[model samples]
Target chain A: MKKVKVYVTLRESVLDPQGSAIMGALHSMDYNEVTDVRIGKYLELQIEEGTRDVDTVVREMCQKLLTNTVIEDYRYEVEEAVSK
Target chain B: MKKVKVYVTLRESVLDPQGSAIMGALHSMDYNEVTDVRIGKYLELQIEEGTRDVDTVVREMCQKLLTNTVIEDYRYEVEEAVSK
Candidate 1:
């Protein structure tokens, strides 16, 4: 089996209001060393071996359903799954 | 400046309904090789070097605000940030 980890984040040009809010809150709480905070999404997928290459499958999924390309960017890593 | 990447994931015991919904959609769209999906949060923090250690700061922020320890687990990686 393969385990795919995907991270989706806002594009540099986009305004991340939520992240800004978190940073403000942190500063008020006296964690002033934190200069910035950007929040995003993390997805873990379990896929059984199939006819398609794992990389191809992941790219297709990310392009089709996993991200909003207009404002966000996504990257993924695939690895062999060890039984839990 | 230092960059801290924090990943917060739901504990295995939690039910991830959004993940299930995404998986169902993927199956309907014919990406059946995918067997499971889990969703979580990814946070990127820019921290200026200060009197306190970055690791300690990250751990404190994560415990107090970034995640709910009751139902989530978090891990972090600290690295130097390349200028944009």
Candidate 2:
């Protein structure tokens, strides 16, 4: 099996209100050193060896359902998995 | 400034309902190769140079606010940022 890790982040042009809120909270808590905060999604997928290569399958999934292409960007890495 | 990338994931003991839902959707769409999926949070913080070391500041933030210690675990990496 292979484990694919996908990271989905908002487009650079997008404004992350959630992140801004968190930054503001931190500043209030005395972490004034933090200038900015941006939040994103991280996903890990375990795939059994299939007909297509793992890379192809992951890319297809990302584009189809894992991310919103218009306002978000996604990237992934595949690693060997330790089966249970 | 330094950019700290923090990934917060549920503990192995915790369940990920969202990940399971996505996996089910993928299978229904004929992507049966995926066996399991887990979802987590990815955060990036822009930190100004402070009196304390970056590592110390990051750890404090993660413990106090970025992650819920009981159910989630967090890890981070720091990279130099291009000032605007």
Candidate 3:
């Protein structure tokens, strides 16, 4: 099997309300050292053997469903899964 | 400033309902090559200079708020942030 690690983040031009809320909460909690926060999604996928060219397949999946390409950017790393 | 990347994942012994739902969706969409899916959170923090021992502060933040240690595990990477 192949293991894929995906990171999805809002585009830089977009505003992230959830992140801002967390940042504000941290500040109120006395973590004044925090300058900014950006929250995103992380996903891991295990692909069965013989899955069509892993790279192409994963990229397509990200584009089709894993992310909202208009507002988010996603990148992934693929590795061979170790035997169980 | 320092940039910190935090990754939170469900512990191996814990079940992930969200991941399972996504996996089922992918299968219904004919991505039968997908064997497993795990979903988690990614956070990026910009830390102000002079923060008391960044490592200590970030670990505390992760343990206190960024993650739920009961069923999740978290790890982080810190790097020097580039100024705008």
In terms of docking quality, how is candidate 2 classified?
high
Model 1 misplaced stretches (Cα beyond 4 Å): none
lDDT of 2 by residue, A36-55 (tens): 89999999999999779889
Model 3 ranges with Cα > 4 A deviation: none
The TM-score measured for candidate 3 stands at: 0.97
Alpha carbon lDDT at A11, candidate 2: 95
Could you tell which candidate, 1 or 3, scores higher by DockQ? Answer: 1
Winner on lDDT (1 vs 3) = 1
Q: Can you give the lDDT of residue A60 in candidate 3?
A: 88
Task: Write candidate 1's Cα lDDT for B7-82 as tens digits.
Answer: 9999999999999999999999999999999999999999999999888889999999989999999999999998
Between 1 and 2, whose DockQ is larger?
Answer: 1
Taking the candidates in order, what DockQ does each have? 0.94, 0.93, 0.89
Give i-RMS (Å) per prediction. Answer: 0.6, 0.6, 0.7
lDDT of each: 0.95, 0.94, 0.94
Q: Sort all candidates by lDDT, best to worst.
A: 1, 2, 3
Best by TM-score: 1
lDDT of 3 at A72: 99
Candidate 3 local lDDT, A1-84, one digit each (tens) = 999999999998999999999899889888999989999999999998683898988998999889999999999999999878
TM-score of chain B, candidates 1 onward in order: 0.97, 0.94, 0.96
Best by DockQ: 1
The DockQ ranking, best first, is 1, 2, 3
Best candidate per lDDT, number? 1
